[model samples]
Target: MATVRGEDIVNTARTALGVDYVWGGNSLTSGVDCSGLVQQVYARYGISLPRTTYNQINIGASVSPNKLRPGDLVFFDTDRKKSGPDHVGIYMGGGKFIHAPRPGASVKISSLAEGYYMDRWLGGRRVSGVSADPSSGGGYAEEVAPRLDAHELAETYGMSYAFFKSQPELWKLLNGAVSAQWTPERFQAAVKNTSWWKNNSDSVRQSQVLAKTDPATHKATMEAARVAARQLAVKMGAILSEKNVDQLAKNMVHLNWQEAQVQNYLGAYVKFSSDHVLGGMAGAAAKAIKAEAYRNGVAVTEQSVLNNAQYLVRGLTTMEQVQASIRQQSAGLYPAFAEQIKAGASIQELASPYIQVVAQELGVPDTDVDVYSPKVKAAMTRANAQGQPEAMNLGDFTQMVRNDPAWRKQPGVADKTLNVGRQVLADMGLGF
Candidate 1:
């Protein structure tokens, strides 16, 4: 069973204080009758009650007026002709109760001492699961001194005292839940559950905190931020002057904008100049730019490359230049593939010797080498281009062929292909 507290119930009910009254209405925001408010508040804390004053009066343990605490259902015989209790409200500490009095009255706090209520007080009943505060003698428990002072607690949670002090209701809710058993973890949970903490944008919350706690320092910081925003605006070709500088600076402080972010946004907005080679390029273009710089033996970081990309990409090799270099390297490394390279064979085609060996491992006959070798080469080209990743690497290609469906389907071919694969490797001065 879940634990329940009258403190929590009171806290929940307080949220609907201004709701309008409508007989039989169940909503907390729009409207709720007296019984509806009590039913809804209990339902939030996982307790269910009858929907009307008459039925709700008998469910919970009866508590006399002197022993009533927050969360006890307070009844009143408002209708003179009615036989039993005809209206209800949830008791809040301090001799007060909250309810939807009638069709015209909105949900509001009312004193039990008020003459009208004093004459009609029916009784108070404590909800079964709502834990009573023995120390309060039937009222809400007095708040105990926290282990850490407010300022210390605020600092521990990375907030200023002023920001913490601004949230009294939130603090009250948290204190009600964990004040008796305060631990750092429990207190931190309370802090994390707050809207202020959940939405604590550093630029807004932190900047606001600084502005309140130390105005002199905050002024200096805002000035610095303003200056940075102006310089960035100028760099990005945005207008900035005395007339709008203060507002722009305040906006920057609120937004947490800095140089790199502004540059990235403006870079995309204006688009890079055509002569600036890498200016507008990103993703694959950026990757190609980095590879080109590396191949050219130039040292450059992604950031540095992006910063001066338009100029940097100009120094990179073109596709034709790369092909010429490959042709030159191929002639020096493998003269036999020179004609094939000149014939426009792809890099995968140049690995024909390895592909033939893989085809042979799949039990492809010598007479079929010409017909099947192309298939093996095609497998190494690219998946989108018709090849598996396993076929891309020469070392993994033979194993891929060995695992091929064609090879596995043949009877008595495995042992013969294994021996053929070994002999093929030996002929190439290599071994498994």
Candidate 2:
């Protein structure tokens, strides 16, 4: 038997495009059913096929939907009640096929992209003896084959079209190596030889291999990635519409992101966004940390401090919770400020009112209160740093002020000291 060209078989099928449909009828001139149309078309090319859809599906090697070429036999389950393919058509290039319909319909061209056909699509088969050109490239079809559609193949391989298009070498190799009789082993070998594939990540390569070796797992993983992307977007306050979510999911699948990796990415994104926003929870935390760092004489940036506080941000749900976390961190870092923070007053708030009281007691001008307030706080910080008690109080402030030159300069200070000395001496029976 002579080898038949696929293009010739397609031409033969086209000749029966106007023929009427008849159940089990084998003559193309009279009437023919779907399988009859296929049988008669292949007979013209000298390639014998089975008489019915069920047997015809098992005629030769099976074809992936994405790998379908012209002259390949495509099958569908028109009747859901039936167990397997009950309808058949001859695939034409460019997502179309020619087939006869039920009783009154004639043979005509239809699209595989149509919803009805896609939903009912079972699979495709490449019959033996069909070739693009058996005489070319040492009887191999790979050399003379038409370029495979990259967009379709990308979708089949579970990659985004944009990403697939970006890699010129991958698509170029795919179009060059793939033929109607392509297999997963051949495809993997061809792709692995490329520089991009060899240098690519293991997870990504595994996902690509899985798409060919185990389509069911690959599809489920891709779907799970989509769901995870959406959930992470929501959690991070990232505005992701359905379209954005789909693209993100595709990218993740292409990169082979596990759930934990996705969470880390979203967490970093949320932290970066919140830290940059003024008046956000992260800003508040940074501000609090900055104040405590200053009081403790520790040098750090607002951004750095905020980053360090991320540990506290974890598992926290609200702004209030975040605020409380910041306070707790500050108290932990500077134990001396723990009392003031617990009392709901920042270091500045605790120092301001008490500094005014100390200045008034020493009869210092109101204008000097601001100048002395920092000095008093600094003294307290220094004292705490020197192994003193980790508490802030009025007594600490007063003692710090008394030792200062500003307090000693107040009027009537000498006479008051001499009077207090004479009273203490008279009481002890050693009066002047």
Candidate 3:
């Protein structure tokens, strides 16, 4: 599951390959600035992250570059004038990251070994709520300590914590559940199954410790189980109050039912208990399941669920197996593509493969092919030809736009200014 989630992050980044870099832009089709791309990709997984590069650096726990993981946010102080973070990129593991470099440069993978980047590297920040389990060791640790006081815990964890803590009976029941001998993996899976557990890292750690201490403590085991169950109940209650039970049921088509199958049963429970008969206890659990189902999507049957689950699990495994293959293909090709663009390849020639790869990956029609219209091309060409002697590159064409009076004043005289006036008359495109 961890591997699958990581691959999803990488795939999402890959889908944005070749998108033109635009300052302060975020959307894929329109354009994306550096931070915007990272923000949108994480948002797809229900993780709420800050939008700005500066804010992003401060949100999650800090980690050293050596300890950096695939989804970690790596920051840079691009301008020495800035006191802190000025730019950011999503670490794609193996000493590479995807970022929008600058104007005239599209989204691309860059090496950390580059001297320019090494000098500006500021460190990394991990996103919160992404679990710190040893099995999923890459996630950042929780910076804030857990609240011990029930009232404080209630506030810290939100209403779900309040609901469970208010019922001492339920709390004791759950404490017992955690004390039982369950496989560490199974215990962690159960913790994630509940929405409350998903956000409470401290609680998860405590439960895991309790479960590992002694196998003979039935009361401890039962208490832990009850807490988990009550947490689930509170989540369901919240969903029921929102009147989204039906919608939750509809979302159950994506889960692997054979593994846990909790969504189907929870969907039925929500349908049966609309009146809040169980002191609104069942409502919260139902709502929690509905919320998870909505985010993760649900599967219809056991087989379908298993197949989907296997697909994700195996997809991640396959990705690792073929990493060399993908990198080999990409490394040889991407640099050549970059070289071609720099060597005066037409925009069509330069952008066609990039557009096709990105379009196919993102499931969007290829629109990048038409991004540079013929009119724009002609204008650029005329500007280039006119400014050839005085201007050498795209920057020269830009300067010509600013300085050439005839090119600017005559509207369509770009060709005449360069070909007839400058080249023929031995006059520089710049009048001065």
Model 2 CA deviation exceeding 4 Å by range: 1-73, 76-96, 99-198, 201-346, 349-353, 359-375, 378-432
Q: How well is each residue in 312-357 modelled by candidate 2, as lDDT tens digits? A: 3333244455455556655654466677776665554545656675
Model 3: how far is 384 from its true place, Å?
78
lDDT of 1 at 405: 81
| Clash pairs, model 1 backbone | 276-310, 277-310
Which has the greatest lDDT? Answer: 2
Runs in model 3 deviating more than 4 A are: 1-4, 131-432
1 versus 3: better TM-score goes to: 1
RMSD list, candidates in order:
22.9, 13.4, 34.3
Backbone atom clashes (below 3 Å) for every candidate? 2, 0, 43
Q: Global lDDT for candidate 1?
A: 0.65
- State each model's CA lDDT, in order: 0.65, 0.68, 0.51
Alpha carbon deviation, residue 113, candidate 2 (Å): 14
lDDT tens per residue, model 1, 24-103: 98999999999999999999978988897899999978887767777788999988986799899988876778889998
Residue-level lDDT tens digits of model 3 in 373-410: 33223332342344442212444434433453433554
Alpha carbon lDDT of residue 209, candidate 3?
Answer: 32
